[model samples]
Target: MTRSESVRRAGIENKPSSAEMDNIYYTAQQLDTKLLSASIIGWE
Candidate 1:
């Protein structure tokens, strides 16, 4: 699934651009944490 989709699934109404979302996913992968949903959702 795309990062946008994943973020949406996490219940974030406002979202960043596709590029920004991709960067977040990439950074999360680098950190090896399951904070993808938490981090993005928390930004809301």
Candidate 2:
């Protein structure tokens, strides 16, 4: 029941590193409008 045995059973070849799992992603905002048209028009 060593770390190598646990990793082999998971079947991903290797588990994801902590940095990869905890990484942050950024999304861009587009086309701001009034009267709630932004979401309705799929601008965001």
Candidate 3:
């Protein structure tokens, strides 16, 4: 599945709101440290 699809699925499974996902994606993008999925995994 695509990254967004994965993120959405994770959100459903983990119960994090969309806003949290957006924040994570934005912060990770600014840092250029890792893919959003990696950050999401770390968050979990």
2 or 3, which is superior by lDDT?
Answer: 3
lDDT of 1 by residue, 1-44 (tens): 99878888999886578999999989879776556656876842
Give TM per candidate: 0.41, 0.27, 0.39
| Candidate 2 stretches greater than 4 Å from native | 14-44
* Candidate 1 wrong stretches, greater than 4 Å: 1-13, 33-44
- Note the Cα lDDT for every prediction shown: 0.78, 0.56, 0.75
What does each candidate score in C-alpha RMSD?
Answer: 13.2, 9.9, 12.1
**Per-residue lDDT of 39 in model 1:** 86
Q: Give me the displacement of residue 15 in model 3, in angstroms.
A: 2.7
Question: Which prediction has more favorable TM-score, 1 or 2?
Answer: 1
lDDT of 1: 0.78
User: What residue pairs are clashing in model 1?
Assistant: none
Candidate 3 residue-wise lDDT, 1-44, digit = tens: 98778978778555558999899888878767555557788853
Model 1 residue 34 CA deviation in Å: 12
lDDT digits (tens) for residues 1-44 of candidate 2: 98878889887586557775554211112223342586787766
